[model samples]
Every structure is written in C-alpha cells, then in structure tokens.
Target: MLKFLKIFCASMIASALAFSVAAKEPECTFSATEVYERIADNIVKIISFSIDQHRVLERVRPGIGSGIEIEPGLILTNYHVVQGAKLIGASTNDWAFEAQFLGGDPVLDLALLRVPFYERNFVAPEFGAYNDLDVGQRAYVLGYPLGVGLTLSEGLVSGLDRQIPLNTLSWTTRYIQTDAAVSPGSSGGALLDDCGRIIGLVSMISSHPQAENMGYALPIDSIMPLVGEIEEKGYVSRPWHGLYGQMMTPLIATLLLTDPASVPEGFMVETVEPGSAAEKIGIKGGFLPVMWGFSEILIGGDVITHVNGQPIRSREDALKTVGALEVGDVISLTVWRDGVSLELQAELEERRNFESDLWVNGQR
Candidate 1:
C-alpha cells in the first residue's frame, strides 16, 4: 500500500511539472535542420525563359533562380532573374491566381514580386536586424543553391560597405561581406540568422583569380521596409542621396561621428555630385578626394549626426532613415559643421527610381 501511494504521488508531481513547462514561452534557436525547413516552405524555383522556344519545343528552356517566399505567393528575387522577361513574354494567366511586376530596379539588381491568393497567399519571411550583424561573425547562408533545392552554408562576414556593379548605371551599394560559397544559382537566396530570419540576400561574387572567398550580400536594413512600398504603390522610386560618408575615427571621433567607416576610422564626406538630392537638401559634401593608408578616399564635407530625431550611428542607419521614406517623403536632419551642429528639413524628391523595375524596350 505504501508503494502504491508513492507512485500516485509521483504521478501527480510529474503532471504538475509538465503543465508548468507547457505554460512557459518557447526558446528560439539557430538550427541547420530547422532553417532548411523554412527554406523548403519558402523557397521556390524561379523559371525564367523565352516563350519563342515554348512554341517550338512545346516547352521553354527555363532559367533557374532562387526566390524567398515573402507574403503568400509574393517572392523576392534578383531583377536580373526577370531581365527581359516581359519582352520574352514570360507570363501567367489563370483563374485561381496570377502574377505581375510589382516593384523593382534592374540597376539596383533588386526586384519585388507578388502572387495573388484567393487573390494569392504566402508567408512573408521573417526579417532580422542587420544593425546587429558584426564583422567576422558567423552567419548561415540559405537558398536553392545551384538552383537545386533548399540548402545551407556557413561563413564568417569578411567585408562591409562595398560597392558592386550590375550594369553601367546600376550598382548594389553599401553591402555586407561574407565568405560563404556563393554561385550564380544562389542569387536572391536568404542569408539568415540563427533564428531562421533573413538578415541579408546572397547576391554576388567576384570571379577574379586572385580573389579569395570575398562575396557580397545586400543588407536586410535595405529590404525590410520595401515590403510596404510594393504593397501600397505596386512600385517604389527614390533618388540617390549622392553623398559618400566616412565614419568617425578616434582622431575624427573628436568630431561628432554619425556615419560608418570601413577601416581604422575617421569621418569625412566625399562624392556629392552636382544637382543630386544631397545638393538640393543642402547637405554639405566633400570637395576633394584624399588618401588614407593605401586607399584613395574622399574626405571633407559636413558630417551628419542625426536624422528625423534619430541619432546617426552608422552609414546603414542613415541610409535606412532616408531609404525608408518615399521619394516625396520629407525627412529632417541634424549635421555637424566644423564641430558646430545645425538642423534642417528636406522634402525628399525623386531623381532616379533606383528601386523600380518598370521598363519598356529595355529602357525606362
């Protein structure tokens, strides 16, 4: 009888313990297996091709690209994936759903796509904060690598604030660096955090013989807000700020810093093109290019310290502040001039739609 009593008592304790555990919130993780499942559910094969062959072979020789499913049916891929797609007449027309160009810029090498559910439905991949990413940190690379299937690779961030070329007038600017194995088929894949949220998009790699594992990915800081623009306007357009920034160094740190420096730091402004948005907004830009260490760097303009009441801590943050608003969206600023800070408001204007894919006859 004593043994029976003990067993019943233990059973009651176990039940209480189980209930307590169930009542607590769950913990997040960065698991390889779990990340793949997210990719499996989110990644789709982008088949781009010309229909001229569809008529001949009764099927098109579809080119493959990786895409992350954002909102149900909405996928994000590189604009190059759909380059000349409309001209080639790649399309969809059905009753359950359909898709059309939403917003993108071939110059930026970025594109936004929507798929209708009932009208179209799909998951908007969770986004991670790029501000949290540190140089030399470990991160996961997820995507349909080689246009095969969902896969993950591990690498350390090796670079920051890079400019990559896409076309004569187009370039992806201010990107994060990673040493992960990237391939042509990996374009538009997700560079995710441990919790399986996207922090960047695996986009480009250098084919130089002397190049190591250097590759670049566009930061999530640039992508998070784009979701809203595509949804509301079916497109997005904005003018280049037309200013180059340097971070505050221990030397320049004496000057109020508010931007990012890619190397041993000190802040400066350079490359403000005449008549650019930065000019119209009255932001001071550097007049001459200077040399630092072995790098010929641009320097000497007014340093920006804040925007819209937000303290400018890095180049990415400042870009985010301006990039988040529309072309006509107004943004205010506080800048440091020779150590004296001043404030101003600039109604943002459009000089180039760097984020739009709207084109015809291969021209905007």
Candidate 2:
C-alpha cells in the first residue's frame, strides 16, 4: 500500500510539474491562481475584535471587516461586518492598511466601509439587480461560502416572493426564497447574477430536514436602502407591522379572499394565537374542527388584504408587508370576513408580551 501510494504521488507531482510541497499549494485543491488574484483584488479578511480598554487610551482605533472594494477605498459588506472591529486590507503590492466603516444596516445586512487614502484605487465588484429574475432563473452565488474564502456555486432561484420568519421585537420581513449552496459565513455575501450587479445578500440558510438549499437572501430593493441609511445614521431604520403568518397558496387564498362566486387574493388564517398583536386588534381566527377532507377544509378566519396600505395578494405578501414595521406603529388593514371585505385600523403591539402569552413562560 505504501509503495503504491508513493507511485501515485510521484505520478501526480510529475504530471503537474514537480511542485515543491513547502513552496506550493496542493495540486488537487483550489489553486492560488484561481483565488490569489481575486483575493488580492477583492477579498478582505474579517478580523475578530480585541477587547476595548481604557476610555483614555484613545489613539484612533481602526475598525476592520471583510469587504469587497466596490470603488477604490469604498468597500461594501454586511453591517455586522465592522460592528466592533477595525477594517484592514492589503495593497496591490501586498502592503496592508487599516480601513474604517463608513456606515451600515443590520436589517439589510449591508454596509459601506472605507479604506484609508492610498496610492492606488481598488477595483469594485459588479452589482446586479433582480428586477428581471424569474422563478426558474439560474443563480450563481459568489462569496466566502462556509467562511472558506472566495468560492462560486450555482443553483436555481427555486422561488420568489418568499417571506422569512420574524424573530424580533420589531416587525421585519422581506422576500427571499431557498437556494442550494449557501451556508454559514456566507451571510452578508452577495447572491449575484451572471452580470453580478448585486441582487441580494446571502443572509441565512434553513435548518429543516426537508430544507436543502433552503437559503434566504435579502433582496436588492431592501438592501440598497440600508446602504444609504447606514451612511446617514450609522444604523438601519426598520418599519413595523403587527401580524405574522405563513404564505397562503391558491387553496388557502380562496378561504382568505372570499367564499362567494367572486373574489381574488388573500390569506387563510393558519394559526392565530390568542392575545397576539393581531388578536389584540380584533383579528379573527378559526374555531376547532374535525380534519375531514372536503372542498374547503381550510378553517375560516381573518382573510388579510392590505397591511400598512400594502395589498396582501398571497401569504408571502402578507408576511413581507407586515414584517417591515416597528412596534407602536398604527396600520390600516383590509380584511375579508364571511365573504365581505372590511377595513380596520390597528396599533402595533410588543411581540414579547404576545409570545409570553403563547408559551406560558410570561416572557418571550
């Protein structure tokens, strides 16, 4: 076995060009030529933060984060990037310098950072838009997937008009669908188009058994605003809504839209917990019923229409419209009840209280 391995090793080295193990990277693995230029040209190392001490030791501490030099010293990354660190990078000649975070938005997972004035300008990566993206479009992911460094993978858009789960005190939701090839450390990375104009930010991947390639990206529409806001306020200003729900399909849509011979779009109430933001505002939910198969097995409840003045055409629309709001906001809702459409006004409520009422822990 040992002799056979040596022969194989000699063959590999001889075939490739007798490369020195100490001087060169592995022949089979990703090569320097594939990345060194890109890394040298684009990749910025994410430096973990060191403890801050002494309020008086002030000497202009630099904040460092991984970034793609969009236009010279102008870098772009997730807000969480330079959250508490200094930005540092290397020059074309391999000379390193410290950069600073100009601004950022945690809500959108995008940020703008600036490198100190240097002799040579850095080339910016292309930004693409998803306005023309279709459900079946071939999507390519370019970023440090798995924190492994610049890598590329391909997958279908799989879906669109997707609303991610809300787990915050403020209502915040956006359109995102699952795709394969996204993983941890990919967050804040670009989910690019073939032209790479910056379609979305790879934000999260799913954790469900049925969810492979169930990754979500913050759409460009939502991310661009964050880039500007972070520049103005050093943070993102998110909107608010009181209701939370899963998307309704055509079947679910029928129940929410109307039962009569006429009506088009809306959402069926899947599960509305008691005393929720929706409940507090007089939203209705279904009563218990036996699961007997039938034409309209979907239980009746509040069929949501417009939230904060936006129409809820489907379950995904309802979630995204409502998730983008903050607490204490007042929103007007158009609901369908018993085949009739009605308008109602509501004020946003804290989710923690509602969650507490949900799990019986008294705290959420």
Candidate 3:
C-alpha cells in the first residue's frame, strides 16, 4: 500500500509542476476589439490634395493612408503617402487639422509631419524594439483599407529582416514580413505588438493578384536614427561615398583567390561613381564580371575592411558607420587590393539623386 501511495504522490507532483509551468506562460491571445478601442483615437486618416502651379485645388484624394501622432504636434507616416501632395490634412476621431510635411527618407519610406496648431492631447505611441519580437508572436495592424474607416487585422510575424525593392523610389529597403491583411489605404498605418506598442509601419503588400494577407512593414528600429536627423535638420542630409558594393562572403573570398578564413569580411566595391569621393580617393571598381555557381559577381576590385576604425562585416555595418557622419567629415577606409592592404580616406559629400544619375548614365 505504501508503494502504491508513493507512485500516486509522484504522479500528483508531476501534474502540479505542469500546471505551474502552464500558468506562468504569458497569454498570447488578445481581443482585437479591445485593442482597437484603446488605440483608435491615435490613428488618423490622411487626405492629400494635388494643387496646380497656380495654387488652385486640383484633385482630392481621400484615405491616402493612416498616420500616428508620435508626439505633441508631430506626426509620422509613409513618404509615398504625401509624395506629390500639395496639401496634407489629418483627422482623428473628433478633430481635424492641417499638417505640414517636415521631411522624409525615401529609402526608408518614412515621413515626418508637423501639426503646428494642434494643442489637444495626442497619443504618443510607445515604440517597441524589433529585436525583442519573435516569430509566431501575435501582431495587430490598424489602418483604413479601401477607403473604409478604421480597420484592425491580426496575424503573426511571418518573417524578419526581409529585403524588398521599392520601385517607386528606385531603391530597396528592409522590411518585417507579416501575414496581416493590408490594402491600398493601409500604407502608413501602425503595426502593433501584443502590448499595443508600435513595432513597425505598414508599407506594402504582395503584388500577386491571388496573394492574400501578405504584407510588409518598415521596422521602427531602423528608422529611429533617421527620425532624430529629420527633427534637427528638417530633412535627412544623408552622407554618401558614391560607391556601390556588396557584402563579401566566404565564397567571394575564395573567388578572389584569398583564404576565406584569413580575409576579414567586408564590402567588395563593384562600381565607383566618376568624380565622386570614392573615385577621388582612387578606389577602383570591378574590372571584370565573373560567374560563380550561376551568380555573377564582379571581380578585381577593392575589398573594404574597415570604416572609421569600425570593422565592417555587412552592408548595414558600412551604412550605419557612414550615416552617423556629417557631410565633410573625413572617413577612413581600409581596403585589400592586389594582395596588399591599404588605408584610404575620403570626405563625405551630401547625397544627391545618385540612383537616378546612375540609371540615366546606364542608358548612355
């Protein structure tokens, strides 16, 4: 009888431990209606109007997208929403105001606006770190789709750190992929986490006609640095070195006839714009194009190892290092060329329409 009692006690203990663990787990399910009620007032419908050169009203475009007031008198939305708009207006549940476009980063599809006269209490969205998010975590999207009033959709983070091209801007950007239902009028809405914090800004949806619930958002973390720049200068004066390159990998190192383990990973220069900082500093672009396993990569160019004393392992590392520099700041780049390592210095210039210039030049 004592043996049987001991076995029963063991079973009871296991059951209690399991129950404790289950109780300690966080509740993943949340009411969409409750979330909408809590944040609906924070979301605003953006109306953009196109005006002619004579300043006459041309056309009224309603429901361009939704925006959020990130601070008192400050609004955040997508750049494309107000790309060519002459007049921008925003409306909350009970208030309407005119907003002035302060600045935008087309590469990131982020725009900052100022509601100069708005004095009422505005919701300052709490931003959450993208790094803290995990795949399969619940995500909620709030916006106006198809010109319909405020709508909320729920989904999971399908992917992260996805690279997508923005054909409108002739550039590409990183995005957080989600299965949330987003439509034409959802471009500038907010992607909230389970705690109702802003984690990303809704950007685009899949182009496939049959695609459903495939949407992408610009992660807030990536745009935080640019926000500060826009606030201070009214625009982002992004610094540029005038070079195009790709991050070097082990296979690239092998193709260059260098030991993959011996060479430090960095950007391998492919094209250096003529008369730019890179060319002025004697940086060479690739001389020949070669195919390695069906991927064509330009060979015989300098491999950048470091920027401003920081080791660059990826494109993000190089961009971050450059983005922090002011125009006219001299940046030092360590490069590997002809089996010899050398340090080169270049003064950053204010970035212009480099992409368009490249495209125009390619046609010639």
Q: Is candidate 1 or candidate 2 better by lDDT?
A: 1
Query: For residues 1-364, could you state the per-residue lDDT of candidate 1 as single tens digits?
Result: 0000011122223223432111112125546677656655666556566455436565544455666666666777777666546421212222222346677655456667666555443356778776676665666777665566556787766555565433222222566767777766677777866567787877666554434555567787777577677656755566555555555455443333434332222224555545766677777776555444223444557766776788766655655665566667667777776657778777655655433322322322
Where model 2 places Cα greater than 4 Å from the true spot, the runs are 1-40, 50-66, 79-104, 111-114, 135-138, 154-158, 166-180, 246-250, 253-280, 284-301, 306-331, 337-342, 347-364
Per-residue accuracy of model 2 over 1-364 as CA lDDT, tens digit each: 0000011121222323522222222222433343233434655544434335655566445432334555666666655444545433422234456556676644344567666656765566645555666655555555564445566666656556553333332123454554548655555555655344456766555453333455667676666645655667766554433343333445444444455445446655544545556666677766534232211132566667676678777545754655566767888888877668888887766443222211111210
lDDT of each: 0.56, 0.51, 0.69
Q: What is the lDDT of residue 13 in candidate 1?
A: 33
TM-score-better candidate, 2 vs 3:
3
Q: Model 2 — TM-score against the truth?
A: 0.57
Q: lDDT value for candidate 3?
A: 0.69
Candidate 1, poorest ten consecutive residues by summed lDDT: 1-10
Q: Which stretches of candidate 1 lie over 4 Å from their true place?
A: 1-31, 49-64, 87-99, 105-108, 116-124, 132-138, 157-174, 206-209, 247-267, 279-296, 299-347, 354-364
Ranking by lDDT: 3, 1, 2
Model 3 segments more than 4 A misplaced: 1-29, 51-63, 116-121, 165-174, 206-213, 252-264, 271-275, 286-301, 314-320, 338-340, 353-364
lDDT (0-100) at residue 28 of candidate 2? 27
Candidate 3 clashing pairs, residues 3+ apart or interchain: none
Tell me the TM-score of each prediction against the true structure.
0.60, 0.57, 0.74
